[model samples]
Target: MRFLLIEDNRELALATRDRLTLDGHVVDHAADLATAQDYARTMSYDLVLLDIMLPDGDGRDFLAYLRDIRSDTPVIAVTARSEVSDKVGILDLGADDYISKPFDFAELEARCRAVLRRRAGTSSNTQRIGDVAFNRLGGTLTIENRIIELRNRELRLFELLADNPNVIFSKPKLVDRLFSFDEDVSENAIEVYVGRLRKHLAASNVSISTIRGLGYRLDIG
Candidate 1:
């Protein structure tokens, strides 16, 4: 999944970005609210990790702005404030969940998954496409109860395709979701990943179909 991390603390932002990247997620970090607002306005993110205190302004204002713009993207507030009133206020301001500072990265990731699951309207993190079973939280793919070994990028690509079956994803859109802003990506990067994924799904009842001039889609029989 693609994530926008709105944080001012360089150390904490780096740590959070690294943690999420290990799970095959693409993360873009903004050091201040201005850059964050620019990112929010331009790109589409699966989730946003927002810090309450910012260098430019309060994160609550940004949350309100997002809601005012009618953006439905799920946001989880990451702040140092642990008071019940603070938590309630953040949620009331449009945060889907709240996590205090000095929190565990595992718990943060779990909360991210939970919020995403809720947004997707599914209680379970596992999604099935034909005989392929994908555990979104665990980042595992299984077919016939056997695990299929996939590299991080491969798994990320498959996750996007599986999550939106039959939906055509353009190459640019795939690149945006699969790679971060700082990554040096090649023009044929998406094609390479798609080719690799197709080979892995060859034995299953699922296929990745090229839409020629359009893009690609996951087709299930």
Candidate 2:
């Protein structure tokens, strides 16, 4: 999973980012609302760890902007103990949950898992395409009990396409979702990932099909 942590306290932000990274999530940190906004504009995150007291603006305004823009990505407010009063309004404004300051990092991890499970509408982390099964949480692919080894970027590309199996994603969209702001990725990088994933799925009933000039789709038999 990918996450954006919007926090002003340097120590706390580093701690949180390191912890989430250890747990296999890619995290981007911003110390102020302006920086957070810039990060948000360029990339997509599966979840957001937001601090209500940003240096430049209130976090609620960020929440409202996301809602106004119809971003269904889940937001979890990380607030100080005194900000408990703001929870009701925050939730109403589209926060998935809130974690008070001085929280256990373990608790935050569990909350993230729970909310993401709900978002996926399943307690299970498995997604199937014909006989091939992808364990999204574990980041593993299986077919009839056999495991397939794919490179990290190939796995990410496969996961992105699997997430929206019905939709055709252009190479530009793949570049945005598979790589981050600091990475220099070209459209050719997308093709390489797709080509690799195709070989991995060659024996399976599922296929990653190129739609002429339209880009790619996950075709399930």
Candidate 3:
């Protein structure tokens, strides 16, 4: 999944972006209102992590713009205000979820997944690839009741492939989907993660196959 995080707090934004990437999401970060608005208005994203307070304008104002454009993309508001009315007001303005400042990254990830699953109309929390079970809600992968020891990036790659079995994903698309906007990634980097994941799932019925012109796909028997 891909996300746009519009946050002014530099340290917080960096940390949040890093965590989202580690969880297998591509994140684009904008420090202020202008950049955030431009990206939200012009680009397609699975979700937006928007901070209500901004240097150039209020995040709610941007929300109004988003609604005007008729974009159904989910927005999760991040703000310092914890007032119930404040959260309700944002939700009424089309925000999908609200989290106050100083939140745990795990909570943010859960919100993102919840919103995505709702939008996709999927009620299940677990996805199976052959014998490997991916717990999307809990962020764990297990094979035959035993957890697979996969590093962060590799686990993310496997999740992506397993989530969309038999769909060929190009290298560039995989790179964009797997890495943060600020991260330096290449096609070779994608290959590295794919190789690691292939090894991790070697004993399972899941296999990663390379397409002649396309890219890679998850083949489960």
lDDT of all predictions, in order shown?
A: 0.89, 0.82, 0.82
The superposed Cα distance between candidate 3 and the true structure at residue 141, in angstroms, equals 3.1
Q: How far does residue 95 in candidate 3 sit from its true spot (Å)?
A: 2.1
Model 2, 187: alpha-carbon shift in Å?
2.9
Residue-by-residue lDDT tens digits, candidate 1, 1-221: 89999999999899999999998899999988899999998899999999989988999999999999999899999989878999999998889998988899989988998998788677898887788887776667787778877889998888778767679999999988888888999759999989998888887899999999999999998
TM-score of every model?
A: 0.94, 0.83, 0.78
- Model 1 off-target regions past 4 Å? none
**C-alpha lDDT of candidate 3 relative to the true structure:** 0.82
The number of clashing residue pairs in each candidate reads 0, 0, 0
* lDDT sort, best first: 1, 2, 3
lDDT of 3 at 150: 60
Clashing pairs in 3: none
- The top-ranked prediction according to TM-score is 1
Candidate 1's TM-score: 0.94
